[model samples]
Target: MYVGGGAGNVGGAAVTLASRAGARVVATARPEDAAEVRHLGAAEVLDYRSPDLGEQLRRAAPGGYHVHLDTSGRGLLADAVDLLAPGGRLVAMTGLGRGAAELPLGRLYTRDASIVGFALSNAATADLAEAAEGAVGALGDTPWRPRIADRLPLSRTAEAHRRMDAGGVRGRLVLTVGAADGR
Candidate 1:
């Protein structure tokens, strides 16, 4: 299960990659983003704002998800722990940001589940290049692709950053760097 429906490019990429890899991908997003998330390849898209989100997730994947990738880190650690299958793994791709989460250590130990934190920037250049090569190779047959929210000329780079900082952009905001005809 991947959390972050309206979480922009990273969330969209996770859904697409997981689905292309043949995982039964479930995702959470705002109600308005449900359709887009599904189009991105999520098998099920739950409303994160729903009061019964946990129950909905439980019903959707009764056995629980084998893996949960959290991007928002909006105090969902505990819930992720509860919704994991035995030996399931949760990976936080973003920082919790001065927030403290109370984990049920006993449950984690009993279920043999594990939680890990990761950042793509920590990977070696060679590893990143290999992964990029694999992604390019699979592009033809897979549904995975970057979701562009908007494209602006290089002159508007500052505007793009402003929008990003304001959290108004949905996906990626691309800055066209060269001529349209290809320099």
Candidate 2:
């Protein structure tokens, strides 16, 4: 398994989930976050910004990855596809960088590889419920936990957004509903 964007919240969770499922997950993260992503259970964490990212990934799983989950939203499908094994599945959990992209149909078809786009909004209600239930059930046994870097009353929501937009937030900012004056 190859999980891209291992340092982000979703990417981090993917690492934990894939690892807990007994997969040998190789994840991509910022150079500064490599160690932490590894601790999250990635067998190897490569720097996404490296000029030789694809090469490193290939070396990490020389046989090719059976699954590639892209959380980076960096239009990495081409790179991901090149790293896939026969019959591999690519899950695009976020943006493909733009509106359209050309597929390498010949290789894709020949290898029986597939690309799937996933979003909570498009998920079936039952599937969502099942996943929620599974998450609730698995919480106790998993080491994964949502990181809360800051807490502020609902009144400060804009401030939180500003911080996030400015890339100042390292983890989720919890907004607690409270009085208008922010008790």
Candidate 3:
């Protein structure tokens, strides 16, 4: 498995989940994110900004990846398709470039590859309930504890957004949406 954008909170969660699910995951990030990706349980890390993305990914997963989960969605679906073996699956969740893109549909069909857009809210109600329960249970596990970068008061929301937009903070940027005292 190959997980793209494996440095941020969501990406790190993907890497950890994939690893815990017993898949050998190779995670990609920027050059500065190598350590964080490794800490997230990536067997290997690739710098997406490098010119040798395909080469590095192939080297990391010699048999070709069976699945690709893209979190960045920065015009990576085409190259990701080329990196997969026949009958592989691409799960995309982000729209960094735009909400719509022109993918290589013919190539995907020819190779029996599949591109699935994930919608967390689209799951059946019962399934969602069960999954929610499972998630709540999983939270009790030590490894599932959310990594909180910092907690800021609501007054600093603008600064929090700025820091998040700048992509400088690690882990989750938590904001105290409401105060305990009646304000």
Candidate 4:
């Protein structure tokens, strides 16, 4: 599996999960996140921000990946499809541009590749709360661990959201939502 994103919450979690699932997982992120992604068990980490990102990813996944999960969007999607092997599957989870994408159909037809859209809100239809707990439990014995970028008091959640919105936040931005006052 090849996953693209690199420096956001969805990208990080997908890296860990894909690695744990025994894929020959190659992940893409910015230069600053390569080490953290390696620690997450990625076999190779490419710089997604590089001007030659498509070429870099192709090099890392020479045989091409059967599956590609994108937490970014279609600009990257266009590149990701170029890396697809015949019959490859690409799933995009970001509503980066209203969740609608414009792809080059000729290539998709030639490769016989399929692109699917996903929204995690769909998790609400299933027993996802339990499933999430189960997923976390399944990994307890493994080396997987999410890094916390910052911890702030509950009242500071506004600032946390602001920082996350402004971009460039890595790992997880944890809001300590329930600590007693004056602790």
Over the stretch 154-181, how does candidate 1's per-residue lDDT look in tens digits? 8788888899889757668888877852
What lDDT does each candidate get? 0.77, 0.83, 0.77, 0.76
List candidate 2 stretches off by more than 4 Å. 124-129, 179-183
Model 1 residue 124 lDDT score: 100
Candidate 3 clashing pairs, residues 3+ apart or interchain = none
Q: Which 10 successive residues of model 4 have the least lDDT summed?
A: 174-183
Q: What are the clash counts of all predictions, listed in order?
A: 0, 0, 0, 0
Model 1, position 122, has a per-residue lDDT of 94
Q: Tell me the lDDT of model 2 at 63.
A: 86
Q: Scored by Cα lDDT, where does model 1 land?
A: 0.77
Q: What is the alpha-carbon lDDT for the whole of candidate 4?
A: 0.76
What order do candidates take by TM-score, descending? Answer: 2, 1, 4, 3
CA shift of 97, model 1, Å? 2.6
Tell me the lDDT of model 2 at 82. 86
For all predicted structures, in order, the TM-scores are 0.82, 0.87, 0.78, 0.82
Q: Clashes in candidate 1: how many?
A: 0
Candidate order by lDDT, decreasing, is 2, 3, 1, 4
Which candidate comes out best when scored by TM-score?
2
Cα RMSD to the true fold for all candidates:
3.0, 2.3, 3.2, 2.7
The lDDT leader among the candidates is 2
Deviation (Å) of 178 in candidate 3: 5.8
TM-score, predicted candidate 1 vs. hidden true structure: 0.82
Off by over 4 Å in 3: 96-99, 121-133, 139-145, 165-169, 177-182
